[model samples]
Structures are given as structure tokens and as C-alpha cells.
Target: MDTTETLQGILEFIDEHITDNISPEVLAAQAGYSTWHFCRLFQWGTGYSVMAYVRNRRLAFAAYELSSGKRILDISMDYGFGTHSGFSKAFRRYFGCSPGTYRLHAHSNRPFPPSLPGAYKYLIGGIIMEPKFVTLPAIKLAGFAIKTTSVAGENSKAIPAFWNDYMSNGMMEKLHAEKFIKKHDEYGVCFQEDMTTGEFEYVIGVERKDDAEISGEYHVCEVPPATYAVFSSPPSDGANFAAAIQGTWNYIFNEWFPKSGYEYAPNCNDFELYDDRSMPDEGKICDIYIPVVRMQK
Candidate 1:
């Protein structure tokens, strides 16, 4: 059989035996190739090591099973995680939330088997745009903060709601009215507080002077100086602006980071800057800044 057909057959085999122990050696035997040769071929065609693809598939199935309301511990063991803690860790890393949180907030469908060759490109979005690199000075921001987790995309829902509340409930005006405010431009900053839990603090605020006075009611955060890769969301109107921005974020994490030759800088902040271009009209746009360092060879 040809490469495509061989890969498809292996995919089917994996689905059939997902909960069973799967290894590259076994799959290599099934594909009639040496283990090393099979592994290289698999990664080249799928953009994932054989085990990573298998683990992701298993996690996808585990996510779908969450909807059944089974006990998390039992389900974890059923999926070969061996323990609740192990399962939770893997689940949080892969799906961006704990299995329990995912159960409450999201329902996952059975993962579709990817077509061979270039399949990973379509996993998130097909388009990847070039980003402009910049070095930014330290920034001081004073604003409201909400604790949120990336679990089950909770951040995705909470942030928008937070913005709506901020904009509509006079918080936006109140902050803009502050004498300490340096500019009308707003920033949505995400600070990773607990990587183990995928929890972070998200701040919605305007930049302030370094020496500006701050109030007790407003939370203050200072972003350290760092080099950033800035990405502009595709031009979009008011109606689809949120989706466009979310899409760009998905592209950055899923598509760009893997190929960018850079990784997220340690203990740094990533943020979205909203300026006049973000006005609720045609051609609305915003910039996303991610602190980055060159990947070690």
C-alpha cells in the first residue's frame, strides 16, 4: 500500500484499540517497517511523534467520555492514566483544563482521523501569518483583574464577559477618567500564575505613568521589558471581531509557535493592545504581543 493508505490504516487501528497499550514498536510492526523508519515517517506525515498523536487521540476520547458523567477517577483509569492525578495533569495540558472543569463547561466530540500529509496544518487553522519582532520597555498598568483558567476554554468565555462588564458598567470610563491614565489605549494582559492548573490572572486596564499614583480599588501590574513578536488580528468588523482575535490566538499557539524558532519567554506577560483601530467600526484591529526568546539549539 501507499503511504497515505498505510497511515490511514494505522489510524483506524489506533481508534479500534485506543484504550489498549499502543507503542511505536507495535505500530511499526503493523506497518511492515523498522521501528526507526516508521517513527520518522509518522512524524513527517503527521507533524507529531507517534506517541504524541496517540496520546492526543486518547485524550480526545477521554474528553468525549466526560459527557457521560462517569467518575473522573474511573474514566482516567479506563483511559490508561493509572491515577487521577496523572489523568488530570495530562488532561489540563492537552485540553487546557481539568477533566471536571471540562465536563462542566465543554463537551468534546470524537476526534476525526486526520488525513495524511499537512493534516497538522488544519488542526487549528490553516493560515499562519508573519509577525513583527519588537523590543518594548517596561509598562505599568492599573486596572481590574479577574482570576481565570484556560480549562475548557473558560478564559475564552470569562474574558469577553469581563470586557462587556467593564465597558458597559462605567469601569472603562472610570479608568479612562483617572488622572493616572497615560493613554486611552487599553490592554488585556494575561499573567500565568499557576501553570499546573492552567490558571492565570487577566487584567483589563490602561497604561499608566511609571510614577503615577494608584488607587486601592485598582490592581497594579508591571510588565517587564522584553522582546516581543507582535501579531495583528486580521481586519474585521464589529460582528466578527472577537472570533477573528480568538482565531489569531489559536493560530499563534497551535501553528506559529511550533514553527517560529522561538518559545515563550519565562515569567513574562503576553497581552493584547487595543487602540483606535479597535473602535467598533469597519477594519477593527488589535495587536497581540507575546514575549519570546530564541529556542535553544
Candidate 2:
């Protein structure tokens, strides 16, 4: 099958088996790729991770069916969820109310933006993709660090608290990691993981090649050379970063991944292009990069 065929087929299969226990790796394999590979391409083309999309679809369908008179138990079972409460929780996430309440207010505007009637109508986070196909070699680095759970946004207390220390200590004013800076005070370094993916205790740090006399608690990572889809994000007063990231994922998974024959690298950090640099007054600028491996379609 063609790359497009495989991609669309997988989506179709997902829709048909919304209630099945098929694993993500199995789904990716059916698409003719590995688990991580499928995840990347799926996100690249669909603008959401494979699993994220599945969750969205499941809730959307469940909402539809329950409103159309399907029993909650049947609806829950149809989505492969183990119990009605589980289904209800997921449904509330999408509809901003219990399925029962959702059915009552089906025609009303959703209290939650992310769970609105047409919430899934648009893909999440695809702005500023301005992607460029570029290749570069990975290098080594050093910097400050703190360990915290993987969070969808910096809403986690640890990271926000980190900023408290970051500002109080004047770490931002005097960043010792200069080599990573590209242009416009734009540091080549960026965030590399998704917290919502159940990752815990990720380190927030920067890279310094030279002996910058690293202080505080931090570690170093060796970035390998690879091809990437880099997207520029607007500067922020620390808000909307999550939106931009989410939008980028939606665009990649919805529009790019299905069309591209590339797969995602397993067990590696995704990329973030820093555009806002140091000036929040610059109007929120940053870019995101997705790591990829070309597949033989």
C-alpha cells in the first residue's frame, strides 16, 4: 500500500475498532512501521499522537452514540474502556460534563474549549510549523538541572517553582551556555519531552560545550545528528507555549505524518526551536522540532 494508503487505512481501522484492545505498537506495525516510528509519522501527519487521536475519536463517538440512545454501558464497552466510570471520565474530558449531562445539553456550547461539540473538528497545535528539512550532527553539552515528572504544560508546581529559582538566582540574566545560542538571543537548546506521555522526572537544563564551570544540580546529554521538522513558535509571557506545542503536534500528525514516509525515532527526545529567546516582549517566539526516520514506502 502507498504511504497515504497506510496512513488513512490505520485511521480507518482505528475508527472501526474504537472499542478493541489493539495496542499502539500493533497499530503502527499494521501501518508497516515500528512503534516509535508510527508514533512520529502519525503525529506528523495527523497533528496528534496516534494514541491521542484514538482517545479523541473514542470520546467523540461515544458522545454521539449515547446522545443517539446507545446505553452508557454499551458505549463504554464499545470504546474498549474497562468500565463505565472510566468512559465517563474520558467523556467528561471531551464534553466538559458527564455523558448524562452532555446528553442533556447536547445543543449547548461546551463549558470546556478542549471538549466542545466541535472541539475535535480542528486539530490541536499546528501554528508556526514553518518546517524546514535540515540535517545536523549531534553534540555534547552541560548545564544546570532539576528532575520532575513529565507534564503536559509547565503547570506542574516543580517547573513553575524552578522558574522562581531561575529568576531569583538570575540564571536567565546570566546564562553561561552561549554556544547553544543561534540568532536573536535564540538559544538552539529547547524542551525535548512530552509530559503527558506518562514520563516522570525529566530534567530541565541547557547545554554547554566548553568548561563553563557548571553550577547547581544539572546533567549533560549527547544529542545525535538527525533530520528534523523545525517549527517557529511565537514568544510568550510564559503562556500559550503549551498551545503552540499542541498545535504543532496536530499539524504534524494530521497534515504531515500521513503524507511523509518517515517514522519516528524510538526512545529519544523530540525537538523544540527557541524563537522567543529571552525577550517575552518579543511576542512569544519558539519553534518545535520532531525527530524522524525515513521509511521505504
lDDT of each: 0.80, 0.58
Instruction: Tell me, by TM-score, which candidate is best.
Output: 1
Query: In angstroms, how far off is 80's CA in candidate 1?
Result: 12
| Top candidate when judged by lDDT against the true structure | 1
Candidate 1: minimum summed lDDT over ten consecutive residues — where? 118-127
RMSD (CA, Å), each prediction: 9.7, 7.9
What's the TM-score of each model vs. the native? Answer: 0.62, 0.55
Candidate 2 lDDT over residue span 1-297, tens digit each: 444556777877877777787667779778777876766555444545566677777777777676567788887887777798988888787677998988787743212213212222222333434477777677454444555433223335565586568658867556644444323232233333341252333333454544445545445665567777775554444566556555555556555665676666555556454433634653565666667777665
Cα lDDT tens digits, model 1, 89-202, are: 999999889998999999977877766653332222344589999999988889999998654457668989999999999998888989998888999998754533446799
Candidate 2 global CA lDDT score: 0.58
